[model samples]
Target: MVRYLAGFPTPFASPANAIPANYAPNYQYLANPSEAGSLIWTLNMELTPIYAIAPEGPYANLIYDRLINALAGQLLQRPIPENFAGGINGDAYQQARTTFSNNFVSRVSIPGYLTGKTVTLFSGQVVPVITPQLRGLYAWHTEILVENAIATAPEEDIARLTDALTGFLDRIFFDLRNFGTSSADRALNYAATNAFQTASVLRQATGQGMQLDTIDVDRSPFCRMDSDCWDVRITFFDPENNRRARRVYRFTIDVSDAMPVTVGDVRSWPIS
Candidate 1:
């Protein structure tokens, strides 16, 4: 079995010298299926490749199809270069870039298991290989994530909620970034994506003038026999009177199997 890992699904031109000397500047060429074989897929964090992806098993083709779809989507959103060989005009190109820029574009999330094998690229860099799990694969944009919960919030409240949610996500992606090898890290990584419950709790907390205080993961005492579990606790407190009012929400995650799952309902309590 491979180690579990999560990161951005980034596509790259494999070899440093893969680009042809006379390659045309046309973007349409990228959408051609024939060109797909030359691209290398990788799971990246902070724009650094952590693992090179090599899809295996029955889902390989499906994974490839999804990746190609992401590429096609990005290309469709990109503005054509002004002097490109393609006959696309200036107005259409500008409009495409403007729309893409104004909106919060979604990025593909590839979370799965590593094959415990290493592969060397043409550039002599070696990276562990990962086979993505189709179950957790998704495309997400941060604002789109919490928009439904805060739909009717006042304009000022909406901004605060978005900040709280994104701050939680950014802290995980940057501050607590890890390989997802340990039971705790896996639970935390999974929590970062499946955060709708957290958002809901945050809405309730913020209404009472609470702010996110801390996030912690530890061994779960409530685990079933023969199962490995961890409890992820998200705490909130009143900024004005930090010592007097606080709340803690906890959810248990079982990671004994290849895919981790929530054990039961999210439990919460007060901490004064």
Candidate 2:
């Protein structure tokens, strides 16, 4: 059940480095053998195979290394307190260590081209295939990300902002979960992970006593030549004012290539 990269046969045997030259012949062994040398790297959301990762390009070996290290619980590193000692606040240290350890591989941001091709895994479940962009691959801890996002917030606003941002992210991860294949889905996923715009929007809305009401992604009517663009809207509403119009913030993201990017500045206005 829990096997190391060493357990996999050759081609996959040397997991510490470059892609094996013999990887092509082992296509049949992969969960999705649709492409030569494409290995199935399952991206799980709480044990559910959300997408099958097919790391491409010259840095495929690096991608595999990250995934394998994450699986082995070696991807995250937390510095021990300088004052740490045996039996001297050891319980607190242990608790902190446990919490940090549990967060390993809890959240991963993989920006990739979600292909139309689908593959059936060994478990018989079908999932979309994605060729990851090397620069966008990030294995993160949700708590750390949240902390970083709110690190500069005023002390008085930190508590509420933390709650609002955390809740918003939870909704994306659970309620609006998707297969990451559609352009809109890919754009939305990219926006959420990138977090700069979303975090700014969340902070602004929460500061004004508004709640994150809905997140919507739709194909953008405006697009540059040969580019696939989508608009992601995050709306917030005042619970106290039932008749008041909602505030909506929208941004355009282009998913035309392997890596998606925000096309322009985020725009916001009130909408009924």
Candidate 3:
């Protein structure tokens, strides 16, 4: 049912930009939980709600451009915990909200949303407020909070974005290590491009096929195998014929000399 509704793609900003490019809340909080639940839950990206009410199409983006420009200096930075109720400035943000409300109803792909819709957002729960028109329902807002916590001296938001990607890369590499079976091939699947010192044992997919379930990154000191690395969940097809067989791989990457994790070209394995 929710699938019938549209989702606004979260926007991303360049690292070099001095001010946030979007009015969407500008910071991210990656959780390093004390316990491991499932994969997706562990890898969620935190957010402070970014409230906007607009119609889609030419006007949707235009309104955001206006709004961001309206709050130029305040665009990007860490979200204040107290501001979870919504934007910090009542007058300014309310103005932007009103601007969206007044303008969108008549625009192309406009949402039938009420004048003052309350939009709530969290890590995995950014829902769109929309009503279907003859043209079908469409997303109303796309203004992503480009991350609010910014400092001229702090680690750039772009770096956090990079960390987000690399962290996932680390997860993928973490998964690929146990990708295949040993009887199928005693050899491991450690690619030359992988930065981890531990050569992951790769295996072959036998019996039942397996799904590349989910990638979970462990950020806490107790759960993580390394002091400052990851305890990642990886899956593989095993001799038991289970479709969801998995393993946990751990590696600590030194930040001072860290390199981007790269996935190598897939090649035919040496059959045992």
Per-prediction TM-score, please?
A: 0.73, 0.74, 0.19
- Tens-place lDDT digits, model 2, residues 1-272: 22323122232232234432212111122332232234467788778998888877788767766665455443333424432333235554465465555545567877777677899998899988887777777777676678788888889988897898788888888898877767888887887687656778888898788998999998999899999999999999999997988999999999988778899899999998
Q: lDDT for each of the candidates?
A: 0.67, 0.71, 0.29
- Stronger candidate by lDDT (1 vs 2): 2
Q: What is the per-residue lDDT of model 3 for residues 1-272, given as tens digits with 9 covering 90 to 100?
A: 11111122233354332322223432121122211111111111123222233434544434333322222222323433233223455444454344443223210122133334444443555533432122212222211211221112145334544333334345543444331222111112222123122222221221122223343334325422332332333333344544433543333222111221222222222211
lDDT of predicted model 3: 0.29
The ten-residue window of minimal lDDT in model 1 covers 1-10
Residue 257 of model 3, lDDT score: 12
Superposition TM-score, candidate 1 onto the true structure: 0.73
TM-score of predicted structure 3: 0.19
Candidates ranked by TM-score = 2, 1, 3
lDDT per residue for candidate 1 within 6-92, as digits (tens), equals 122222333332222222112343345444445667666666777887777787767766665554443332333442222255454
Total clashes in model 1, counting residue pairs 3 or more apart in sequence or in different chains: 0
